[model samples]
Target: MPEENYDFMMPNVNFFGPGVVKKVGERAKMLNMKKVLIVTDTFLRDLDNGPVKQAESSLLKADIAYVIFSGVEPNPKIRNVKEGKKAYIDNHCDSIITIGGGSAHDCGKGIGIVLSNGDDLPALAGIETLENPLPPLMAINTTAGTASEITRHTVITNEKTHLKFVVVSWRNVPLVSFNDPLLMLDIPTALTAATGMDALTHCVESYVSVNRNPITDAQAIQGIKLISKYLRRAVANGHDVEARTNMAYASILAGMAFNNADLGYVHAMAHQLGGQYDAPHGVCCAVLMPTVEKWNIISNPERFSDIAELLGENIAGLSVMEAADKSVEAMIRISEDVGIPTNIKSLGALPEDFDKMAENALKDGNAFSNPRIGNKEDIINLYQQAYKA
Candidate 1:
């Protein structure tokens, strides 16, 4: 095989497996970070109930000073970022450690980036706007999706505009990320299923993205295979340590792929549903995955065929196009098997709002990376297909 020229990006350190949560404080100490600001949500700050307590206890045992700013919410808003920034400054924190899922990581990134750059949150809305280096930051991921912990992108909603803005920069990437399956033992089955599917969607979209290269293809395919083999098991039995471990590894692999290759319409469309309806990001991705892939198969039949084979679809003598369609069918089957709703209507999205959601999807940053460039009408049609399932 010829050497491929590709820019593969990832966090400096990715710690995984059971009992790895203990390493958070060690990594922070190595970075010379003493006083840390822990960014998360109220639900994640309850010492007895939150996963963050695990890290907090580890930090305390390590004799590292810290303060908690647990105000982050789902589809995290700029207001949350502002409040977190104040907390970071008020506590005289030298570093940041985010504990939870993407929401917590994103809020931490937002606060850290703004504080280090001394720039207003609104000014850093677009891609690579923060020119200066950010403060030392670490992320501990509890979900199997989003991959925000390891990525340079952070999606923060501008409440006034009712639109989600993605802030991207190499500087915003965390210094380290911890993925401990032991910490994921308690996530509900529904959340496990939804987040697992979101990881699958990331692999599928990145594998077929316009920016995909050989390096990304390897990670994406491995991620797809792992999700196919383990997502159901993890969802069925959250306490299955092996299943959770495979899922955590799968999420990290998928994150590395999309972090560089980027995503496609599934994420483009799902972001709108999440912002507008406050729907679970993974559920929205699960609902839209099959429909968007169906639309995309014609544009890149070979890529979809590869996906079909990876998912264990029987494509024996079928043509590429037929095999591609089989991949879409496989996605839908897996979604149903994991208990995802069959249609957007189940999420309370009305037909009347389809136009607005479609418009937003069309304008999403991830849409530009899709193999098939879709206009407003195409997006609207896709929404209709998804709405009816």
Candidate 2:
């Protein structure tokens, strides 16, 4: 038989710390970026002292010209990508810089994907579909979740169908990624909780992914540890520099893990809720993770046991199955401690929609990597479990 194989992917370059945002201008100039397009949301652009202004300061110092596209919504939409493409073309932008969280990064990727290929965004959905290289892109992240800045994946929503689709391609990875903890200090407590838990979900799902390898295992384990220790602190006090910094590391590490090993049912199921309700992606992940894992534990009890230990659960005396169950318990405990809503019902999900959500979830790119195999009925029951959980 042929040997098993996998590939690892991340940004070409990365900068992490408290003041790394200051490097954007010089980096763009180094890349020969003339007339750059800065993609963000209106909120970030309007903030008096937000990351966008800081990036502008650096770009101005480097004498790089740029136009702002701040039309990105919570779950980036097809129209947002279309409008961003128009902005890029109209401004004659030779490069792209995205500021803010995953929405901004994904939107930036979507814009570049269509510009380099064609205008049909929906037609380009799925893995390794892009044939052309995106323009030089830099992502300056403002949130500690989603990790879109470094990954080869981007999620775009089709507003007409109310469905989210994944676009995965090595070419879509950003040229550079900046993670400055200082920018995350102003994030609200609820957002902090949701995004941090999102990082945790990435660690867990990637650790148990069917495609996991030694490299991904190491990163995922460390990500779980960092998130377990610092997420609560970051939520309790946004100004905790140490928490912010470690959480940044946690997010990047988890991104690195999942970017290669890929994800599982948590992301698959979460994507549906996000598209259906236009809810927060991280929040949806946080709510559904434990339920999904509860079903997935049987696929690899040792991996779940490792996650339990990483989360600081006391499983010394328990059997492997019992210890594996602690992983789900630990997830729930941390989720509740960080203020995630108890169930999807609170996020506006209805029973009538579960069937369709389940159908779309099974078709999601992440579903293939899920450790456990289940049918439509199993997926629907998982949704029901999360709804009442």
Q: Which pairs of residues clash in candidate 2, taking residues 3 or more apart in a chain or in different chains?
A: none
Clashing residue pair totals per candidate (backbone < 3 A): 0, 0
- TM-score, per-candidate, Cα-based: 0.95, 0.98
Best by lDDT: 2
Q: After superposition, how far is residue 190 of candidate 1 from its true place, in Å?
A: 1.2
Clashing pairs in 1: none
List residue ranges in candidate 2 displaced over 4 A: 1-3
Global lDDT of each candidate: 0.88, 0.94
- Minimum summed lDDT over a 10-residue window in model 2 is located at 1-10
Tens digits of lDDT, candidate 2, 20-42: 99999999999999999999999
lDDT of 1 by residue, 275-313 (tens): 777788899999999999999988889989999999989
**Candidate 1 residue-pair clash tally:** 0
Tell me the deviation in Å of residue 133 in model 2.
Answer: 0.8
